[model samples]
Target: MQRVLIVEDDPLIAIDLQHMIHDLGYVTSGIANSFDSAKRLAPHSDLALVDVNLVDGATGPRIGQFLAGEFGISVVMVTANPEVVADGIFGVIGVISKPAQPATIKQVLEFMSTYKHQLVAHPPALRLFTCDRRGPL
Candidate 1:
């Protein structure tokens, strides 16, 4: 099972995400509400669902870059403020608008897991940097 890190500031949301991930058959590596906590949990995670405007301000992009670039983890931005990363960020797969449906989350997790381990070519419906189905690719 793949290990996922939830970088959300809201405790309720984080717990909800943890339960959801667990129910989806994935392991929850940990939850981090700040950059420091993210750094500590990075090595143990294979994928990360990050939120912007975290407890430490709008550092989701930075955290995503750090996790993806430094740790080679697959990062998907899960932020309500999708505009913040509209231009895309280095090392991030893409952004998922907040209040994501369980089906969307499931598809993304499946695509990412397969892509990471098997180098799968297709991406989920989300606006991935490599496979932008909604815009010019």
Candidate 2:
């Protein structure tokens, strides 16, 4: 089973994400509201669902880079601000907008599970990026 770590600041949102992930048949490694907690839990996860504006300011991009580059973890940015993708951070495989529906989350995760190496996007909704292909959605 794939283990996912959620890096979200809002406790309620994190819980909702956890429930969604569980419903999709993936294991929730844990939830982190800040960079420090994310760093600590990154090692135990296969993938990470990150929020752009974390409790510690806008550090989600940095955390995503670290988790992907250092730990070889797959990263998907889940944020209200999709502009973070413009930053061109490394190791982010995809971006999912905030308030993600169960179907959307399931779709993204299904894509991640299959095309873990390629850059895949769900369009106007979820945008994906890979090292080979990097640009705005």
Candidate 3:
């Protein structure tokens, strides 16, 4: 089972995401409301669902970079602002828009599980950022 970390500020949303992750057969490593907390939990998780805006402001990108660069954890941006992910932030595998459906979440996870090194987008509506070993694809 893949361990996933939820890096969201909203307690309610975090709980919902936790349930969704569990239902999708992924284990919940932990939930972190801030970047510091996320850093502490990064080592234990295989992947992370990061929100662009958190309790510590818009620090999700930084956290994603740290997790992927320092710990080799996969990151999928789950946020209202998909544009942030479109900025071509390093370490982010993909972006899933806010109010994610269960199906979309599952699809994203499956894609990640198969293509761990490449970037992808969920729901097909959002822009996909693909990358290869050399660079963006």
TM-scores, all candidates, are 0.89, 0.87, 0.88
Query: How many pairs of residues in model 1 come into backbone collision?
Result: 0
Rank candidates by lDDT, best first. 1, 2, 3
Best-performing candidate as measured by lDDT: 1
Model 3, range 32-73, lDDT digits (tens) per residue? Answer: 989899989988998888898998999998888788788888
- lDDT assessment of candidate 1: 0.84
* Candidate 1: Cα lDDT at 92: 82
TM-score of 3: 0.88
Query: Which residue pairs in candidate 1 collide?
Result: none
* Candidate lDDT (C-alpha), each: 0.84, 0.82, 0.81
Report the lDDT tens digits of candidate 2 across residue range 1-137: 88999999999999999999998889988999999999999889988889989889999998998898888887889998887576556668768888899898888777766665565555456675645123343
Candidate 1 residue lDDT tens string, 1-137: 78999999999989988888888999989999999999999989998999988888999889998998889888899988888888888778888887887778888888777765465554444677753222334
